[model samples]
Target: MVFFPLTHQIPIPNKDIISWIFDDPKYYQDEPMYIDAQTPSHSISLSQARILVKKLIAGFHSAGLQKGDCVCIHSFNDIHYPILVLGIIAAGGVFTGTNPSYTPFELTHHIQTADVRFVVTQPEMVGSVLEVAGTCKIGKERIWVFDVLGEEVPDGLRSWRSLLGVGERGWEGFDDEVMAGDVVAARLFSSGTTGFPKAVDISHRNLVAQHVLTQEINKKPWKQIRLFCLPMFHVAAVPIIHTSVLKAGAPAVIMLRFDLAQYLEATDRFAITEWYMVPPMVIAIVMSPLAKNYSLRSVRNVSIGAAPLSRESQRALKGLLDERAIVTHTLKTTIQRASVASYQIPKQNHKLIDDNGNEITTYDTPGERKPPSLFTTTPNQAPVYIRGPTVIKSYYKNAHATSQTLTPTSSLATGDIVYCSSTSQEWYHIDRKKELIKVRGFQVAPPEIESVLLSHPGILDAAVIGVKIRGEECPRAYVVRRPGRQWEALGEKEVRRWCEVRLARLGRF
Candidate 1:
């Protein structure tokens, strides 16, 4: 049962891995599939997918992207992102993604910090690349554009397709001598709420484990469709993309972005079997008037994670789906607060700490450490260990972070709280270590809301929170509007409602 024995005492074998889906080997054999976005999309069969990825690896090599090199992958939910990632890994370069919403300055910081040498983005997004071009080590000439605007390659930037097309035969050398331990895959960013985002270093071993483990969990080998709306920048779904889909060999009905009406329409159109989401996306589908309009017979599983799923939202989601639908969630796991060594539920929700500086033993008491299969630090000392193939090794370029984030032996500190079931030996997520509201289950960082509020001509500053009413949480904003000019026109209720509508992209209120 001991897969990899390291110093932390926590072991990662097939059993401890978190992917709970079932798989079928037939699907992984490489068949034609689609990554849908609007009316147009990219298609790749197993043979096609493999070839494209290897070509990218070859292309990257040709372009001087090699092992230990860093590349920032920033794109919408294109079918090509995964292929690009595989290519990056195949090329032995560090592969990380950026939040499409990141500011030019934020993008530049990560680029420099990660020492990224290449930038891959969509045509429209090239502007953002241009915004930070001067600040990054990689220049415009090195900037590569994807098929974001159909076939229209951006001027001044090279085409990603061209890179792969010319190097079609070069990538076959992947398995020849590349050791399994080589660091390859990556997902960048922090707890998605804490301090600055860091580059998560995932290796070939990490990804293969992810693929196998996810295949085992999903009960594969059946005809099913895997639906993904979230961007790959988020690691919560990283395992699913690499492991589940690869193993299942199922076709994906990908959405470049989320829209309630479009989502409902697509759900009815594709009859998606596996749907992945955060709470906000779930609530929007359930709460939208369009919810009642779909014939989503194919959707058997609703996967939610990356944030707390409100009991209210959970019920609402259930109400929207078929009565037979199953809701499976991997809770938002985090490290216990750094300030207190004993694992305590945030906001004083649990009291497991004792006066003697030790953990308390009791039934369901707060502040008590819940032995977790997964553990990661936000800024804590203890190392995190989870039984998942998708776990990353350390932060890129920051030795201080790498040393601090990893145990003396190297178990990762997930920074998200997790509770291991004593009876089940299964890990259950508890809560986040930072403050971020879930507007319809989507993450609404206070800073994002504050920035949005301040954008209004009459607003100065704002703070936001999830206010639960009868156990249902929604975003409530506190704002200081520009010094008084007729408060009635910008009534709090009106503005609040407006904010709700405006902020739906962040998450449904």
Candidate 2:
């Protein structure tokens, strides 16, 4: 069973990302929306950000940068990152971000993969960037330093200020030839847990459409104060949080790096009302003793992304915070496919099949022995194919991957499995196709067992992996105790009994 929220709809503009975000007259000249919490002075107002974007674009044009070019951002979180990203988009260029922790070799792979024509990074990353630039045949002149306060431009390099378009206070937008549907926005890579990462081509239309869709699900509040500490490279960070802050004209409090102490401090200091974080961070906060010392009562809602959150953790989070505080699980269709499929599995154009390839009509009835997967469909009864302006054209230059992932009509098989409740039609995402565990002739999802384990009061975090014991494959769990808990008091036997009480017959250890 699948259901989508029936929220009020809003008009999504058919224009470049620059115009789409800043075009809102109400947001224009608004006070500093993007706040660098670490350095309050560095925060950018909407009007200031727009001016910087125009200057950056004008500078790019003056430096002979052309359309369809790519810029790779390799830096930590900062106010300048958005300006740089929007500037690239406004200049009709594709922008890809690099993980700051990436090694020189990993850096080289991403820079070469994205065909990065320009590199914007901080002073600390210059060595790795220079090494990768040497291998990728990129010129140092095209590299600039940002987010490095008061640092003189090193020899043979430039500062971001140098690229600011000096004379263009009121430069016009991108060339008229650039349309909303044009393939010029983001080049995001998958998490690559299964294998090497694949570059996803996200267009301006896909981004704007996703923004509008998000607005329906995440209703705008009267006063918006967003907290962003996730890595900017992830889809949840840049595409979702960045756009959300921009569209809502909210004050985005940013952390240069995620520190639990600083995170708790910020919650109290800012009276942060909105929160977004990954599952591990959620566990860290819930289990941390220091969290109790902070006054986080102002937070009205929290969102978990990047991975699934067990119901146990969700419940615990709500109890730890305000019972009324909304805790939501935000799922992205696929990292490699930068598009919004239904958040919940869609009933229309989605079905489960048995071993004989017969459709599984009722919920809770396990389908045939095939691997598990996820489901979604557009409102028009289409198979959630990669249609619309927001869908990517293809994986950058990888024809085989592109062919296997994208169908002739442009829809993608997300390669995720889901379980549905027969009566309520509520979709429960199972595991990835490749990660499904076959135990005693029954398919068991790791997340399912992990969810059950996390429900135990003693356990804070848990991961389930399939292991062979006595020539029989069974589920093995690695568990983390809540902070300050003694393991001896709650041993393996207690853990097994906890699982024994909750999981179904075949799912037990």
| Cα lDDT of model 2 by residue, 165-253, tens digit | 45443333542324655656888886665568777778776676666655544565536787788877676677655565676677889
Off by over 4 Å in 2: 1-11, 169-178, 216-218, 333-390, 419-425, 456-460, 468-472, 480-486, 489-494
- Model 1 TM: 0.69
What lDDT does the true structure give each of the candidates? 0.58, 0.69
lDDT of 1 by residue, 233-329 (tens): 6666566674456545677777888888887788778777778888778756764677777787767777776555545456767766667777765
Q: Against the hidden true structure, what lDDT does model 1 obtain?
A: 0.58
TM-scores vs. true structure, each candidate:
0.69, 0.85
Stretches of candidate 1 above 4 Å error? 1-25, 28-30, 40-42, 170-182, 192-194, 217-222, 332-390, 415-429, 434-509
Best by TM-score: 2
Q: Which candidate has the top score in lDDT?
A: 2
